[model samples]
Target: MTTPVLYLFGSAAPPVADVAGVITDAQHRGFDVCLGLTPTAARWLAPQLTELERLTGHPVRSEYKMPGTPDVWPKADVIALAPATFNTVNSWALGLTHDFVVGVVAEGIGKRIPTVTMPCVNAAYVQHRQFERSVSELRSMGVRVLYGEDGFQPNQPGQGHPSEYPWHLVLEAAVEMHQG
Candidate 1:
């Protein structure tokens, strides 16, 4: 059986640091992983870019391919954006496709691709009324947004436990979504 391709996207959040481990876990669960990052995340992981590519056997993509350029990564069977930041979630919900990662997930909604996202936001950010609206909008659009009690709970600013971000839950949801 062909391994399913997982497009694992990350934003510039603390939990993004654990993306390598998340990739390994996805691979163990029978996914052929392809990594995409927000521009800031790309910079954050710049030192490990080559190594991450080696780990996934595909180019790590941060920028959009130029028009007429053939896409390099395989078509994704499932897409998961973990450590999705406040800006990413809102941008995607509002159809703002400025960056590569958010652009894909935003488009994924219309493409009917099985997609999931777990936000890595602090409580302070959550207090903004727009945050709940964005989350609700994404949910209404059929994107499985793992937030609040079911996913990443917002920690107080400066008190987050990045190591405890629920990557396992995100991966589990991806597997389930792909299976269906």
Candidate 2:
């Protein structure tokens, strides 16, 4: 059986050493994923490591590709942006789709796909008035924005670790999204 296509928009561009486990976890739960990342993420993570073509049977593009060129964009059934950094989160909230990650999300919205975001910004940014408004705006647009236990987590130590895992929340949200 073919798994439904899911696209992950992530900002953990710093080659999170342990991300394979999480990707495998999502795959096992019934998804063939296509990964989109910011340039920073590319530096931190391996493009091949994300398992785009291997899993989805399509090219995973993090940048704008030539239109006439033949590349199959995985037909995303669900779109989730996890570990969403403050920069990306604010852009997404404001409907600014310049970056590839947000661009794909904007495309998802245009397609009426089930979408979710799990933000992991710094505590200060998460507490900012503008940030809160953006979250509200995203929610109003039917986008599920999962907050950390209390707010955002900037990968700080000794601050209650797993409680701030936005990726896990995205995983959970993806299950329901695919099911629905």
Candidate 3:
């Protein structure tokens, strides 16, 4: 089976735990999962987050510190950035690539690869003018920016599993790419 590279970017926000469930589900579906974490997210999850790397059999990239030399990343089949933070989104839209997570995005951009960014930020930020512009630019560049059908509300009352994330949508898109 061809391994599909799945890059998952996280933030330190409270939604990280809920977002973790989505990433975990993706791994169970057989994608080679990568946990591209920022400093705060790394600190929040600490070592337990290692489960993703071990379970998916993929090395996690958190820090930008070079280990003598930069390691080359294998070609990615799909890149998904969930819970993309305000800072991260703006940085990517502005082409500011420094941290490991942002660097991965920059490389992915250079490769002309398929990318998905799902921002789970405050509703206010989502409504912000600049944020809307960034989303527009990302969409124009062919990046799939998913705001879910309605929105993601953790522990939402009467929420059923099916009503949560539309993972089937992601799978459908993945299948289309493979078929094409």
* Residue pairs that clash (backbone atoms under 3 angstroms), model 2: 13-41, 15-44
**Top candidate when judged by TM-score against the true structure:** 1
Q: What lDDT tens digits, residue by residue, belong to model 2 across residues 1-180?
A: 677877876775232334455677788888887777776766676656446446545555568777798656657899878767777877887878778888878677768899988776655565668888888887888888887454344554335354335456678888898788
Task: Give the clash count for each candidate.
Answer: 0, 2, 0
What TM-score goes with each of the models? Answer: 0.99, 0.82, 0.77
Report how far residue 36 has shifted in candidate 2, in Å. 1.0
Local distance difference test, per candidate? Answer: 0.95, 0.70, 0.66
- For the record, the alpha-carbon RMSD of candidate 3 to the native fold, in angstroms, is 4.1
Error of 2 at 80 (Å): 1.2
The alpha-carbon deviation from the true structure for residue 158 of candidate 1, after best TM-score superposition, in angstroms, is 0.4
List the lowest-lDDT window of 10 residues for candidate 2: 155-164
